[model samples]
Target chain A: MSLKKEGPDPKDWSGYTVGLNFGMSAIVGMLFGLWADSAFGTKPWGVLIGLFMGMVAGFRVMWQATMSNTEELGEKNQTENEAKKTDKTDV
Target chain B: MSLDPLHQFEIHKVYDLSLMGYDISLTNQSIWMLGTSLVLCLLMMVGSLKTAKVPSRMQGFVEVTIDFIQSMVKDTAGKEGLKLLPFVATVFLFIAALNLVGMIPGSFTSTSSLYINGALALTVFVLVWIIGLFKHGFKFFGMFCPAGTPILMMPLIVPLEIISFFARPATLTVRLAANMVAGHVLLKIFAFFCIAMGAFFAVPFIPLLAITALEIFVALLQAYIFTILTCVYLNDALHLH
Candidate 1:
């Protein structure tokens, strides 16, 4: 038995992230459902609008997730460069 | 005509101190936040100490969660940031656990509070700034202003970037708080329908149950969103690009 962690390759982690986003969106949708129900006295109809908002929110999260990974990679490179400079100075 | 739902926000003084100009009121929100913190601490202690060859169901769940966050970091932040695995993993567990715990009946979710989210966001914001400084020195400020913009566009782009940078915490806070408050408010309102529309209508309870389950899913999802966003922010700070 390997001690290594399993499930979800890092490159494809976006998919799971996407699922999480959708789940969150649904929660928001429920809220929207409630708000709309109260405001218009139309119970589930508000939920429909909320669900749409949630979908859009999820997409926003997905967009952020996509950009974040690339940015982290860039920070790591900077760290490496700084380290190299420090080493050269010491030598 | 009805009790203000927002009345729940009221605060009562728990301690009086005249010297420091600080009145420590143990607000309902504060109590809820404390409850969340205690639950998180207990869960951490249990999950961390429980190591087994076969693993109990709870332990298995914990292991799976760790693996999920770890993989997420590696994929987004890359192999270089594998060093931050511990921090990333812990944040994920803590936030996710806190969010999910709120799904329990009669539990108040601290993450749903703007105060809590703001605090968390501030911590992350500070962490990113410090990490960037450590790696890039004063150059870290450049994170607010990306490179390669034309000098003519500098005035517009730079300020816009700065505003966006500042808005990160607000965005994070609103995302978590709005979801929590909204979901619970809906649940409470529907539950009211069960009682208010007279005892004859049992139908509302079914939707309430369904929403409760959905709330559970929301708990986990919000936690995931919080953690993943942290990773993304960490990635940005680390990379400075």
Candidate 2:
């Protein structure tokens, strides 16, 4: 009997977390930027820079999440393909 | 009933206490949190009091929960993550219990408070930092810069990476707290509608029941998400890539 587990992969659960992570990263970046500006008296430059950094951070998170998901999918496909090849040889 | 849906989140002082200049008064939030922990402890103790080969219902439950968490840790962080099974299990069970308990009518959801969730997230953040620093030393900083990045891009990438790194705890805290608060407020609003509708109270009652069920699911899901994310962060610390 195969020991392979059934049901959705646990890693798939991480997908639910992406939306919030993206928004929060941007907000946190901007907040940090604002604080830096107030401390250094840079005013608008700080906010602009911070906001940009936050957006970049947000995109980075989305990219990472997408990359990991695709990696998992690739692995799953590889295993399935190998299994199919073995079955074909048996037939 | 109060039409204000957010009224459910108000923290009321149950006992007055102070230390030095700090107000250490016991509030409803603290009481509920304590109650949840105590109940969880009692359940755990009761569930494992007797061991059997065949396994009784309580023993089976305990085993299943631990096994589930163990597999989760293993899957996410690999073999080394199993070392953290007890910690991860405790966190998952505690948050799940707190969220489920909060679903009780008239009970305060301690997790709905930003401060509590913030503290929980910060705990995980500090733990990750300690583990990463201890395990990798100065090499851990290398995580901020991905592999194969040109030196020219480092200036832009480093700050973005740093911001995202710090954002982890913030995201964790906000996600859990916001989910709990939003679910509870939604339930409260629907409940108010069920009462305020008077003649057509049944109209809102159906949706209220559905929302309650959804809230319960969210409670479990949020807890699971929080624990899994903790494991993921721990993975980064353990395996730097």
Which number leads on TM-score?
2
lDDT of 1 by residue, B36-81 (tens): 6787677656876869898887777667767777777776777766
lDDT of 2 at B11: 86
Give the TM-score comparing model 2 with the true structure, all chains together. 0.91
Q: Write model 2 residue lDDT over B133-238, tens digit each, in one string.
A: 9999999999999999999999999999999899889988999999999898888887888778899999999998998999999999899889988998888899
User: lDDT winner among the candidates?
Assistant: 2
**Overall lDDT per candidate, in order of appearance:** 0.69, 0.87
For A1-91, candidate 1 gives per-residue lDDT tens digits of 2234553333344544454455555565556568779988987777776666555556655675677766766888999999999999999
Clashes of 1: 6
Clashing pairs in 1: A29-A50, A33-A46, A33-A47, A74-B239, A75-B238, A75-B239
Model 2, C-alpha of B58: deviation from truth (Å) = 2.3
RMSD of every candidate to native, in Å, equals 13.9, 2.9
